[model samples]
Structure formats: structure tokens, C-alpha cells
Target: MSNQLFIPPNYKPVLNTTRTEKAIKLTKDLFENQLSAELRLRRVTAPLFVLKGTGINDDLNGTERPVSFPIKCMQETRAEIVHSLAKWKRWNLKKLQITEGFGLYTDMNAIRPDEDLDNIHSLYVDQWDWERVITPEERNLKFLKRVVRKIYSVMKRTEYLLYEEYPELVPQLPDNITFIQAQDLQDQYPGLNSKEKEDRAAKEFGAIFVIGIGGALANGEKHDGRAPDYDDWTTPSEGNYKGLNGDIVVWNNVLQRSFELSSMGIRVDAPALLKQLAIANSEDRAKLMWHQMLLNGELPQTIGGGIGQSRLCMFFLRKAHIGEVQSSIWPESVIEVCEKNNIPLF
Candidate 1:
């Protein structure tokens, strides 16, 4: 998909350029500080591109090709733009010798050339990629839920602060979040598709954590595609529940749709890694440097995920188009539509 631009009738930005700039800075600063304190994370430097074929780059859903180039200065070694810092963060946790409760976070920027340029999607991706080392006992469904709750709480606090600062802005998040399993949602709306189910649930709950991604539901179809190596989506919890990972989504009143804010989970261990790699039919990945280290128990047991920076800004600012929040190349058609609707793309 190239572009999927949409502008509501009589749409206008809540904040003008000057106010939007101020709000964006406040959002980033407050959210980063709150998230780091809540998760016990320290900010770290991240790479824009990494050496190719080392299995350090995130494959995403395992199909999207990364932007790559040959480095002449480095003897023609190929370098690939990072899809995400998923795998690299684990390596960092190990190398940095981070404590069990401490982790790292960074401002990750990437170019998703194939991203659908829609109201919420963009080619230029920016996110707060974070990872934290955890004890083996902390690698459970309960722990995952606790972390999700903490992150959600911080998000709500950030929203409150923003609202206090800019009285014109209103809070769109709920005080509490609802949790549901993927299979339960499928059962609730057997006739609807996965996305439709998400929309319905998010709309009703105001905020939700839809658990069990990257694995098949009761209908033998996955709710969404997730990279197997990073999240333990196939593992079963202590009881009947499955998957220690899920997505944080909220209803977008402006777009009148479900909006995803984050995808997080417990990192895959050695056993889970082998199982997931085989399920993905990419067992050859085990031979790669990062994969080898994981299989050998050289990496730390961690939980991490990326929170979309621009998407959050767009949501908070109630902008109809993602281009309004981030400066990125857009199709001429999209430009025309935004201009017609009085949306100023940054």
C-alpha cells in the first residue's frame, strides 16, 4: 500500500504550528522521563544502521526489506537500516551488564519505505525503543501485565500533565485499561475480521491490552503478525492463558478508530527461540551471530518494546494525518487532501 490518506469533513488542527511544536516537546520530555522512571530504564545511544547479515536487525514481520547501502569506507561492507532495536537491545543488555531491574531506552529512527502513508502511518518511523533485564522469575504473564499497567499509568499521567498545561487539550485515555485474550475477542465477534474485532473492543473499553499476538487464534489465524524471536507469543502461562505479550491500543475519537500505541512482550528465551525460529521456518537464523548468542544463553532475559513517538504525538494533538506530526515525504494526492482540509504537514 502506497498511501491511505483520509481527512474528516470540516477538520482542523487543534494546535497551530507554534503550539504543536511546544506540545510535541512537552510530550516527548514528560513521557520519556515518566517511562524511564516507571521502568527503571536509562537512555542509551542507538544505531541508525547496523552491519548486514549478522541477525542484529529486526525483520519486523519477516518480509519488509530494509533500506541498505554498501559502505565504501568499510571495505564495501553492506549496512542495513534498523527496522527496530528489538534484537540489538538484548545484546546491549548483555554487553552493558545491566542490573536485573535496570535497562536501556533510546530514540530509534528508521525509514520504512514500504509503509502505507495513511492517517496514522508514515515512511519515517520514530519510537522509544526500550529493554530491561529481568530475573527468570519475572518472565511470566503476571509480570508482563504489571509492566503494561505501569506503562499505561505513565501514559495516563502524561496525558493529565498535557491537559493541565494546555487547557484546550482534553484527555482521550481512560483511567483504567481492559485486558482480553485474542481468542476471546475472536469468539466475541466470530463474524468480524481481526481489525474489526480490535476496533469494536477498543471502542467499548476505551483502552485495552489485546494479548496473544504472532500466534494462531482459535480460528487458526493469527490476530496479527509479530516477529517470533523477540516476543514469546507461543508460550503458555501458568494457567489457561497464553502469550506474555500484547499490544496497547486506545480508541481514537478524532479518527473514530482503534489506535495502537505499543507492542511489548517478554523476550524469548533459548528454548522459546529455537521453537519460534523453527515455526517461522527460518532455522538458519540460528547460525547468525546474535542468534548464536541467544541460543548459547549469552544474552540477558529481558522484556522490551517500542512506543511510536510520532503516532503518540499525533494522537495527543488530535491531528487527522500523521504527516501533520512528523516531517516526511508524502504523495501529491495526500498533500492536496491535507491542504484542502487545512492540515499543515510539518
Candidate 2:
């Protein structure tokens, strides 16, 4: 099924194209400054792709094929565009000798060719991928929740500043974030599917952090699929809590649906890595250079995640389609539908 789109009746953009560009820049700058300062992170440059066999690339959901090509100048060695820098950040943390408190954030650009063309899903992905060095004692659920709250606080701050700058834009985000485990959501709505459950929660809560994702719930199904190598999804979190990783979802008033803005969690350690790799049936990946370093205790204990740049712009700006915030290709059918509905597509 194609991704759904809905434009509220009597809706109009708070800012036109030129003002939209200005708003996007302001949002990026304010959020990055807030997030980096809140997390003690420094900005850095990042690679667009890496060597194929390095195991540094994010294997999102363990199924999506990466966009890869042979480097002619490198004697046919292949390079794969990263889906995310979940692993590379940890290695870089170690390389840079970033102490136990500081971290690094970078603007990561990627091409996900297999992505579905829709209001939310796009072939081009731009995000702020960040990682922070932490002590081994800080890998527990409490620490994860604390970090999540910090990130959410930055988001809320950005929302306020955005509304202040563009008075015509009404603030949609709540002052606080609601936290719930994925299993609890499933239990609450036994008849509904996972996406439905998320939508229901977002509608009810306005802003929510669905915890315990990536692993099997009581129903023998995952709330959502997460990669085994980066996030410690299988690890238990204080009683029934399943994953330390979760997505930040909010109810989009314009689209009238659940919208995901970020995915973050603590990085996997040696034991978690081994167990996850075994469960994924990809133990051969353990021999990869990055995995070997991880298994050998060379990388630092860290927490990291990606915040979608255009997605944030779309949400805070109250746009119906993602193309209104970022430039990317759309199918003829999609273009026709969007045009017919008076949806703006850049």
C-alpha cells in the first residue's frame, strides 16, 4: 500500500517557500546547538560511505539492501553508502579519545535506493547521527531513559523557538513526553496491529516514547524491527521492559497520523553483540574488522541515535508531505495525487 497523506481542511502554510527555507535553517541551527550542548557533543565531518566488508555500516532492520558501488581507483574495492553511522561513531569515539562524558555529532547524508517513495519515506536520508562516550556503569535502562528525556527536552525547546519565530505556526508538541513499553501497548490494544497501536498511543499522548522495541513481545511479534549490531534490543530493561532502544513518535496534526522523528538507544556490548548476531543468524559478521574490535573490547561504551532533519522540519512546520521540506524525487502517480490535493512538493 502507498503511504497515506491528509491535508487538514482550510489549511495554509505558516510560511511560504522563501520563509520556509529560513525556518528550516533556524530549526537546524537551534536544535543542533541545543542537542549538542545538552549532550556535550562536538560537531564533526562524516563519511558518505565506507568499505563493504568493514561492518561499520548500519544494517537497518537487517533486510534493506544498501546502495553500493565499486571504487575504480581503489582496485575494485566496493563502498556501500551507510544507512546510519551507529557503529562508526563508537569506533570514532575510541579513536578520538573522547573521554567518558563528551561525544560527537555529524551531519550524515545517505541514499537509500530501496526506500518507498511516500510522504515520509524518501530515497534521500539526512540526519544528525550522534554518539556519546559513557562508562560501563551507565548502560542501564535508567541512563537510557535519562538520555531520551534530554533529547526530548531539546526537541521541545526547538518547538517553542520555532513557534516564537513563526507566530503563524501553532505549536503541536506537548510540554512533556509520555513513556510506555511496547508490550504494554500491545496488551492494551490486543486486537490492533503494531502500527495501529502506535497511532493510538500518539493520538492519546500527543508525544510519546515507545520503549522495549526490536524484540519479541508477549504476542511473539516485535513492536518494531531493530538492527542486532547497534541497539541492544534483546536485553531486558527492569522487569517486563524489553529494549533500551525506542523511537520518538508524535501525532502529526496535518497528516493526522503517527510520525517518527528519531530512533536511539545504547550501543551493544560484546555479550549483547554475540547474542544478537547469533539470533540474527549472521555470526560470520563477527569476523568483520569493526565487530572484531567490538568483541575484543576496543570500542567505547556509548549511546547514539539519528534525528531526521527533513522529518523534523516537516513536523514542526506542519507540512503535509516531506518534499515540502527537502528536495527529492517523487513518482508520477504520487506527484499527480499531491498536485491534485494542493500539496506542495519541492
Candidate 3:
């Protein structure tokens, strides 16, 4: 990954007194308003922590664990910081009695152990996670495209607003976001790596919603890794192998460049969930308390995903490094380079 296109240069990030402030404030506000309008999302309360040993936690790529700390004076128990509300949102949808087409969004913060933190990646995670129910009829490609169009509309609106308020911020966003499958991307550029494919797609399409993730592709390779329990790679009620098809929420992330802002997909139902769990070799989790409920059909059939708040901020704000938006510790080499470049770590 280090040898990829993101090698840091001897460049310094200049700080403007007002641009940073205005960019962050306006972008966040627009995100809140846009997502709500697109998905009919409502702001709601979310948990800061969850009890240890309860399956009310997220398994990020099936590798990272939640940040855990012992409750004061509590024995044999600890609370875990949420990685994301991927599972919790579905549960909440049912608990809150949310009807179809109506969903909830919450500010989610988490810690990832294995992230290679850099300009786009960060240790301190913050995102907007949302989920809504869909009937069997509404689960096809058409509905997904409609929802993606709605999301892109809000993004375009926000971009226009940003340009209106700050003339310096210029982004050439297409009125309609592009649609493509992962395998199609692979066929278009067979020699390019996964990251390279993303770069090409974003650069070519301006805005795109890549689908068919989570499941392996025609070349027997998956474009990206996703937790099996969250998505259905297999079609419902068919013993046949289910193909991968998911909706991405992406756009021109940088001022003049394109990149993904979010990767969201419709979740899997019972049998497919069980199949994915087995494939991930995480069938052991199925024995856990919460997993038992889901296995027993006690959970809702819903679609959900996370949208990175800082990533979006960084992309739209046209910042070179993620540190420009949030405060966090960096390596000595990074610090020295950042200082030389006059890039504010905060």
C-alpha cells in the first residue's frame, strides 16, 4: 500500500484563516440536511458504549475489535466502544418501529486497529450510519439506482452551495452519478490493482456507485472485503451461488479528483446470512447470544452502511491531509514532514 500513488511529497499544506472553518461547517451542515432529505432520515440517540461479551458490537472486516475498558468497580465485565452501528441500526429500526422508506442516522465514532492511517485514513473514526427497510419487490437494481440518484442530488446541491458560499471551491460534479459493477471495472482495467481501479473509475465517471462487492468476482477475487453477516452474496431461497451486487455512494471526493465517500449495501437475509457466516469461518459467532437471536429470525431484514464524516469533509474541503480536519497523534516522520510543509496537524 505504501508504494501506491499516495507517497507523501515535500509539499506543505498552507492553512487559510477562514477557508478551513467555513469548509468544515458548511460541508457538515449540508451532509446532515442532504442525507435526511434523500433517505427521509431522522436524527436519533445512539450508544457511546456497549457491554462486553454482548454481540451488540461490529466486526470491522472480521479482524478489528472494539475499544474495550473495564467499568469502574464492575467485575468480569467491560464496555466496548462501537466500531460502527451496522448491526445496531437494524435492531433499532425494528425497535423504533420505523416504517419502510423511513430510517435513522446517527453520528458514529469508532477505533480501528488495523488501519494504515494517512491523508484519507485516520485512527479516530466518525461517520453517519443509516439503514432503511425494503420489500422484496424493491430490492432490485432499479430501486438501488433511484436511491443512489437521490443521494447524488443532495451531494450536488451541497456542492453548489459550497461554490456559492466559497468561490474558491470548484468541483465538476456530474448531474447524474455513474453506475458500474465491480467485475466490469476489473474487465476495463485488468492490470490495475483494486485501488487503481477505484482511482480510474472515479476519475472517469466523476461520481459513481460501484456495486457487486462482498462476493467474489468472475476472476474469483473480491474487489473489496466485507463482513458476510451484514450482506447477502447469495440470492434468497436459492441453493445456487448468489452473485454480488451492492450500491456504492461515491463522488468526486477531492476538488478536481474522484473517490469513494461511502460503501453501502443491502444486508442479507437468514439463509444467506448463515451461508456468509460459514464462508467467513465465523460460524462460532453464531453461537453467541445476539447471533442466536439473528439466527432465530429475531432480527429485522434491512440494508445499512457507514458514511465517513471526516473523509467527506477532507474530500470536499480539498485538504491534502486528514489532520487538517481533526486532531490526532502522528509518527515523528509524519510530524516533521507536516511541519516542514506548514500543514497543521490539528
Clashing pairs in 1: none
Clashes of each: 0, 0, 3
Pitting candidate 1 against candidate 3, the one with the higher lDDT is: 1
- Rank order by TM-score, top first? 1, 2, 3
The regions of model 2 sitting more than 4 angstroms off are: 1-4, 7-11
Candidate lDDT (C-alpha), each = 0.90, 0.89, 0.72
TM-score, cand. 1:
0.98
lDDT of 2: 0.89
TM-score: model 3 vs. ground truth: 0.89
> lDDT per residue, candidate 1, 109-205, as tens digits?
9998987668888889999999999999998888998999999999999898999998878998988999889888988999898889999999999
Q: Which ten residues in a row have the lowest lDDT in candidate 3?
A: 236-245
Query: 1 or 2: which has the higher TM-score?
Result: 1
The digit string of per-residue lDDT tens for model 3 on 13-66 reads: 333736687678889898888898779988888897888676778775777866
Candidate 2 vs 3: which has more lDDT: 2
